[model samples]
Target chain A: MNPQFIMDGLVAGAMIGLGAIGVTLTYSILRFANFAHGEFLSWGAYLALAVSGALGFLATGLTRPIAPFSFGWSLPLALVIAIFLTGLLALVLDAVLFARLRSRGSAVIILVMASFGASLALRSLLEFLFTSKPAYYTKALQIAVRLGGGLRATPDQLLSLGVTVVVVVVIHLLLTRTEIGRSMRAVSENPALAGIAGIDVRRVIRFVWFIGAGLACIAGTMTGLLVQIRPYLGHDLLLPLFSAAILGGIGSVPGAMIAGLIVGLSEAGAVQLVGAEWRSAVSFVILVLVLLLRPRGLFGRPA
Target chain B: MTGASPIPAAGAPALETRGLVAGYEPDLPIVRGVDLSVASGELLVLLGPNGAGKSTLVKAIAGVVPIHAGTVSIGGRDITALPAHRKIGAGLAFVPQTENIFATLSIQENLQIAAAVLPKARRAERIAAMYAQFPDLAVKPARLAGSLSGGQRQMLAIARALMVDPPVLILDEPSAGLSPKIVADVFSMLTEINRAGVTVVLVEQNVKAALAIASRAIILVEGRIGHEGAAQDLLDDPILARLYLGTGQAMEARRP
Candidate 1:
């Protein structure tokens, strides 16, 4: 069997893990399954794409590729802007839809349904504006670096994995060492207790959206770099993102990362063992098994 | 605990409520118009039969329940409209009956989160103070609060509320699931806290034990104050036992 599948899975798992942090966080704190979260990934990719294109339009040299990587400084610069915009988009959705519904004390099912509607609207908007045609970060191709053992990967893929580790470590420290991080955990555990303990529950909710969306932006940018960017890029990843999050356990950062890798490796193995057509079913199978065996996921505390 | 006064000053009631009406819904209020006053450094127990609104009254004052009309104040400052979270900053701390601790979080984390309202530089010192008060929690700061024994959990909940050093402390049924000995330990702790200048208000089902440590008691019957007096007086009042305490037959049977 080709060991190349391992690299491919790790790279894909890194992206899925990064994206699932947002899902686990939102679910843990807001207590809802936000179907629209996948849309944030699509939005992040497109927003960065548009910003990168704009930079190139202004100055051609700005788009020049960095020596080892596929994209230029402009793509990284665009990534920052895209992150901010995606976070803003999350807040906008919360303000217009989720926040109002929450204030009125809406049911969890209603919030989930609302997120589905939001997801549809977001995906449709991307399709209408950018069309369903797949886009590329750079058409230029580079030689894969050989790391022996018949294993190889592009610089872009390596960079994605590195960035994910840094992000996960940073998030781990934030949740464990920082005050805001503890507040998020406290709110996720018991919101009423949090409020009485003097935590501003509303502020924590807003912060969750902002940071969760920012994390999703990084994942989207990574996906766009590794694969083709399409309106349904995030749509296709919804199941896998959820699988990683639940498998890792809700509200657990490290769990999401490990679960993401497991899902990714399993899918890649499925592609090798079976056919590529059955790749998507891997996440479904894992999710079903988890629901049957361990509904709390890997790290979630039993309810 | 900084800009706002964290303790009531001289001549001002530690906590006061005028015409409080509160519940989950705006139209359906569980706590009817209940005007109550708790003086500084007082240990007061709220007792009642089932559905008497004892919990609701304190919850309303603590800002957990929706107050339709009322004025709650600490240190002569009006805080009725203030959100539940801000009340801690205004010298009021509340501990709910159930789910008071973040079970998934470590004991240190639970205490640290409660102390977030304090200045960053002061947080460690304050947490140290709490550790000194409850050596059991200090023994295992890294332990998950959910794994704590019932008595230890109650202590941790009180410690969390006391983290902010608020002047007025309120709790709802803290002894609900605890044994009688643990209940006594908790009540004695409350008495000590009250003696140290914090006003204490408790909603207790362990009426006899609560009276032992309480300086005063207020019995509620259907969202209104049915009776109130000195704690010692209420304990011996046979009429109070027969009418509202629900232990009339037991008291009569035990009598010589």
Candidate 2:
């Protein structure tokens, strides 16, 4: 029972939780599991890379680290742009591809297949542009700060947790207090009824894509900050992302986050018991067990 | 309400469908050549047996079913080609027969979603007003709509449509599957809503109960208008009841 394993799990869980929110949301509203969602994370990391490279000189002072931090203001600025670009990419993909299939009343399997095809195309393009090698945001490394319980974490890991909290709070406010948020929930429950209620179903869908993609972007940025950014940054997290979403109960935001923590802790614990090579298999095992035990997930309604 | 004059001879009809031809499939028309009009403040009850296309006709008017040929106008504004989501903007609200409310959302959230089309400033006021109108819903605002009893769900469905405060309200089988007492209460609620100045178009199978509160009634048989006249007049003619609903004996036995 190494305390460091639990701390590492918390850091990794924040990233997966952020990514799972979009997966759960898309599955709930669109009624299909989008395999291409992971590509948005990859795209976010690369977009930030490109933006920071192009605009690094303009914010040379901001790019320099202030203190205990490794990366600086430039990465944050790039993150904002990356979030917008990734969200726009998602909207374009939906408008050009998914929307057509949906309007024609394509089956859910078809949408899922289209997503697989999309995932391949996106991953290929990303690798072609950025190469297969890993990229880092900053060359400097920060020392891990020790906590009282024999646990240690880098400053970036702690900062990632803080950002996750802020984002989750913002999403909470949006979902509970805003009109569009209520409309989104209504559409997920019954799209036809939502339409009859005077809600613009298409508009609500577009907004969902924006929020879902934007959050995925932030998750990708955090993952890249924690580990090195690579073309398969999203690919590597895909299993964990989906497992978190299903385990949390599809369509439940807070559920996904909690499931994310559980999945992360399990994977971290599995690595200590088995080996690092078996970490990826942990998500599959947990997902299978949960499905067999409770197909609707912890908080999901009965099917 | 029995002898309310047809069309009022006043402002434009609250809702009008001319030469309406529609169906789920392109070639097979479920409803065709249906021309109907309802005036302001009128309770027009539509009645028919199974496969009579009663629900289809109502859905076509509400813009749920696709219209192949014809025009649907509300307040003289042509809205024939408008999608279901846009019909509410044309001063109309529709309540479908099944899955009529957001089952998982809280009762209050159901009303809030309906009020999304209005300006943000008035949403709270409108929601508060709906609570006042449907006191049963007001008591348990936090309950999931799906958990509600059949009668309560029906009330919530109607209240959801009324959230938009449309001039024309169309409901398909609002009394379907409800207990007899609840059905009576729902019909009275419809009449009450109609008297409050919202024109109502009800598609119902409960002919006797529906006709009681209806100002006008139209009977559909096999996708065409079989009978059209005042509600009391239709109820009085025993032969028409037999031809239209096949319940002539029961309807005649109840006649005073």
DockQ of each: 0.83, 0.73
Q: After superposition, how far is residue B240 of candidate 1 from its true place, in Å?
A: 1.4
Model 2: how far residue A162 lies from native, Å: 1.1
The docking quality of candidate 2, as DockQ, is 0.73
Per residue, candidate 2 scores C-alpha lDDT tens digits across B92-188 of: 8899999998888899888887877777887898888889988999998999999999999999999988886788889999989999999999999
DockQ of model 1, rounded to 2 decimals? 0.83
lDDT digits (tens) for residues B55-120 of candidate 1: 888888888888998889997889998998998988889989998888889999999988888888
Model 1 chain B: weakest 10-residue lDDT segment is: B247-256
Find the candidate with the highest DockQ and give its number.
1
**Tens digit per residue, CA lDDT, model 2, A192-252:** 7787888888988998998899999999988988898998999889999999999999988
lDDT of 2 at B221: 71
Write down the TM-score of every candidate: 0.97, 0.95
Q: Count the backbone clashes (under 3 Å) in each candidate.
A: 0, 0
